[model samples]
Target: MTIYGYRIPMMASLIVWCILWEIVGRLDLLLLFPPFSDVLVALGDVVNSRSFASAVSITLYSYAWGLGLAIVFGVALGFLMGTVPVADRLLNMWVNVFLSAPLSALVPVIMILFGMGAPTVIVTVFMFAVWIIALDTRAGVLHVPASLLEMARSFGASRWTTTWKIVLWAAMPEILAGIRLGVIRGVKGVVIGQLLVSIIGVGALFTTYSNNFLMEHFWALTLILFAFALTVGQLIALLEARIDYYAGARS
Candidate 1:
């Protein structure tokens, strides 16, 4: 809906929010809460600054590397587990354990083992995001139609050929969903890494601003996180839509 050349729904809500914040902030509801205008200016400055760029870049670097590793390992492990009962039984328990363990709680131990660096952060992200993907892939394998496998076998397709060409194709849709989720997890890991593991990126700046009670800077870092996460999410959604289109055409 549009009203006065602005989205009525979103614009109206924003107007109401700004008015409420201005009123409350001017009324001195809290010492910690800075005025909205201060936050917007700080956010604008942070976005254009070098510190923000470095923090964002480092975090994305770790996230990308970690996510890549997870996709490789997770898909391989999931394929094996889905195909071989023994492999499934052997690793399922440990995967469950890792999945249940909170990443925040494990950060200290990871730091102790890995010391302080990007490696620890990357490792943390991979460990947390891999299992969901692995499980999804396994489900895809399990759900592959027996008829297709049989048809391939009857046509003299070797076991390897049938497994790769037929079984793997059937599982891809589910696996894609898992990949989207894994990327989100990776983004979170990157943010956490910035905060906890040596704090070289936005997280460190967030801490500095926080210590000095610069609420604007703290909020600014949070805004960066939102933007980064949203960008990744949008990319994933676009990819998913394309995949769906291709799959639909084939079907």
Candidate 2:
């Protein structure tokens, strides 16, 4: 960020927002907005509680399973769509439709199909995340330089060998970009799933806190979720940066 020819750190803006929140909270602008300090204290308390631990574990477990499957299938399908025109022609419209659709509405059908459990939550996360990853990966693969593919063919590289060694490497930057975006979406998916499916895990905590008007606890839990998403996003962004060479060279 910058202002008046001076650069501002990212955390500076966060601090500003925190101050505004604290002011509003102190003034009782909204009963739902608790004081930042009180929220911090509640956060500390929740962090040590067994319920919190269990909730975190359950949420993370579902997140991992969903994201893992998303990556595997997303990348594979993306590769196929990128390399095979027939496949892309067949599936492109459906993929675009899913990406543009309100996937949340499908949760009820998922619940009916999968039943009320972690499986529903996992599927929700996957549904929310997989499409964007596949799209980004496909775009990346399509952008791989034709010369590179010709070089691989000139070297007598088999289809599999060219795909893994040349095409995959060339698309690594955008693939990582897709994964990072998918992860952020997955966080939203997990929350939505838990809240709608059975109110298990962190959803339960949110329900209890909000129903009882425990604003501090509710905001504290929200902050934790936001932090988790931000941390994972930054990590993946760093990994993407490390593969910047591919993007630059391809261009």
Candidate 3:
């Protein structure tokens, strides 16, 4: 980023924040804000624990299932909505409502339906993620050029072939972008679900640490979750970049 006519690297900015955090922590400005060094040490301790491993495994399992289902159903529904006027009219209002709604309020309803189980968490993640993906994918489809469709038709391409090659490729960049955003939301959803419905996985650790006022451990776990989300989001962003290239090529 540029500041005072000088460009600063992102990592440099991060380091500055870390140093500031350390200073504030060491000064005891806030009891909740412990030293970064202590948090790092706690991170090492937490990572080596059996509880951490188990929690991670459960969280990952729920995340994978939720994200996978979200992508599959979201893309299919979005594709249909974009291509079919009737479907779009029928579903658009509901999609917009859900997107704008405070989904946290729905957690209790979800828990009621699915009970205190991994299924509830998976569904929560899916709920948080799917609407945005569907919306973005629909937008991608809507933006697909009419000329491309006509050209495919003129070339004797079947509807299926045109959709598969032309429509999908044209839409891929936005779809991937949506997926990246959805993944981040999905992470939040997983945590909320676990914390609210059942204290399992990383949620369990968060409960234990916060209840015991283990600030170092609490911050360490928070940092781990943040890192995991950032890493996954970065990977998805790279994929989006690659798909953007293809979209440009198609254009």
Write the residue-wise lDDT of candidate 3 on 196-231 in tens digits.
887999899999999999999999999988998899
For model 3, the run of ten residues with the poorest summed lDDT: 242-251
Residue 179 CA error for candidate 2 (Å)?
0.2
Candidate 2 differs from the real structure by a C-alpha RMSD in angstroms, to one decimal, of 1.0
- Clashes in predicted model 2: 0
Please identify which of the two predictions, 1 or 3, would achieve the higher TM-score against the true structure.
3
Best by lDDT: 2
| Candidate 1 lowest-lDDT run of ten | 242-251
Backbone clash pairs for candidate 2 read none
Candidate 2 TM-score, true structure as reference: 0.98
Candidate 2 local lDDT, 1-251, one digit each (tens): 78999999989989999999989989998988988989999999878888999999999999999999999999999998999999999998999999899999999999999999999999999999999999999999999999999999999999999999999999999899999999999999999999988689998999988999998999999999999999999999999888899999987
Candidate 3 lDDT at 145 equals 86
lDDT per prediction? 0.78, 0.94, 0.92
In candidate 3, list every pair of residues with a backbone clash: none
